[model samples]
Target: MPATPAWPPKSAPRLFVADVLSAGLAVRIEGNPAHYLARVMRVAPGDVVILCDDVTGEWAARVSDVGKRDVVVEIAELLRPREAVPDLWLCPALLKKDRFDLILEKATELGTARIQPLITRRCVADKLNLERARAITTEAAEQCARTALPELNEPVKLDALLAGWPEDRALFFADENGGEPAAQAFAASKGSPAAILTGPEGGFDDAERAAIRAHPQARPITLGPRILRGETAAIAALAAWMAISGDW
Candidate 1:
């Protein structure tokens, strides 16, 4: 027998929908996606779409009808079950639109339970559109075969985030001048429910650093010797945390 090929070929596209999504899903594709499918992809009646509900996992649906304004697909059987996301939360400072967008997409693939956009004094881009960010993560989850979606918290100032920090969940702040290396610190901590914080272009300010350090949950750790970009730091920290303490 031949090896089974991946469900989605390189040419195929997939999407994530809301929960309890089974057959006969009234897919109302609007905006750019609608245009792309109707005009570019040239999908018509009987065309297929790969879908996941972030609950029941993924499915294969076929287009039942196509209109000048919209398109619809008949939901098929549930293909895969819900993915088990890690208990790790990613608290990365806002970077440029493109960089932050990339971080959100990759973090979703890496199994982050939640994503928090932090506001630091050095943060170049403090304003984040929650709707857009959520959309990005949702799409990412579908593409990466993840059934569960990462929670996106509203933008919070560094102080506010630390002040309301949960007692049991340790906050692992990635510091250049640090307490210990990530691997060593994480190994010693025994996978304590953690949220990894990475700052923006200028990194955390003096007062902000002090406040976070003072928190009971704060565990300062170093990434490496080389100076990394804010975006690089965020994803790197997430990767290390996931390996040491998160879902493999």
Candidate 2:
């Protein structure tokens, strides 16, 4: 006989729901998500739909009802528990709208525990739409099949962020002027709670840089010899840290 098909087939349409999923729970997906499932994916009764609640975990659900503006799925069984992401945060100075959006999407895909946007003297953009930002992260998480979403915090001024910095978490500053190599620094602080801070377009002003360096938990690190753009630095630093110290 042929081998049995896998439960929650890989081709199933995955979605992150707002409800706390449980066995036999009926989930009603509405609005945009409903349109994607009902019209885009054209899911019908008995079709398999993968759901994640962020709080609980991943689950296998079967479509029980379909409507013009909604689709209901009955949770079948839990596939896996919410993943344990690294205790790493990405604190990047606000860049342009499109650039910062990239940072948010890539950070979520790379498994950042939290994203703390910073407002520095050199920052071109100081405001972030939390709702839209959260949407970007949520979409990225779904595309990457991540069970848990990254904590997206509102943009805070650089000084305020430094003042309220946690005592235990190490803050790795991506200083363009130069400092310790990123790989070496990350390796040394492996298995510790850490956060990487990258500057904005023109980089941090002199006073801001000095203040950051003066922080007790701050460790200035260099990406390489060449200077990187705001978005590039954040993404590069995160990728390198994940490869070296993260759960990769």
Candidate 3:
């Protein structure tokens, strides 16, 4: 028996969006990510890689040309179909760029159905660029070999979020203030669509917390005894739910 080649290969294949990927497919490297893959990682022709368009699932690709200024890869074949993501959404308050970026990447790898960036009163960054966030998650998905990209929604205010929230789906909110243990809440939510809500850096104001708690579908869940950073709380909470009530 021989060792099978890695699904993504160890060559650090990059993703691209172009029609018709086959042997001898030519791809142009642009943007910082492409530059980094070409220059930093030192990818060369004949190196196996991965490519995906938000349209189809991931494909197996290989570098056809190692340009001095740009790197081009040819798509070989379709490796896998679009992945089946969970039916859960992560509604997390906006954190600093790096933290939010990490959350998007990790959440994509963990297979969250959707990511809604919430704008609460205490949120440090009021505005979030949807394009950048999508890119972050897209690259992460491609790297993680995910077939489907998680929907990255525009930033919505906390009040508006609570008012227009879907009533049928259960909402598990982290009450930096106090609430039921996460495991218990998630166990009770088995077989139901749910969303995890985490507050911003400064946490939620009293009125904001009250509003979330007032919702009939809302249930406050605890991370633990100690406090968690806004981003950390969101990721940990969702991971717990995925294990308990989701497809983990």
Candidate 1 vs candidate 3: the TM-score winner is: 1
Candidate 1 segments exceeding 4 Å error: 1-12
lDDT tens digits, residue span 112-164, model 3: 99999999888889899888888898788777766678888999998888889
**Candidate 2 local distance difference test against the native:** 0.96
Query: All models: lDDT?
Result: 0.82, 0.96, 0.82
Question: TM-score of each candidate?
Answer: 0.89, 0.97, 0.83
By TM-score, the better pick of 2 and 3 is: 2
Model 1 lDDT at residue 177 = 73
Candidate 3: segments with Cα more than 4 A from true spot: 1-9, 16-29, 33-38, 41-46, 64-72
Instruction: Supply the global lDDT for candidate 1.
Output: 0.82
Supply candidate 2's per-residue lDDT for 129. Answer: 99
Error of 2 at 188 (Å): 1.1
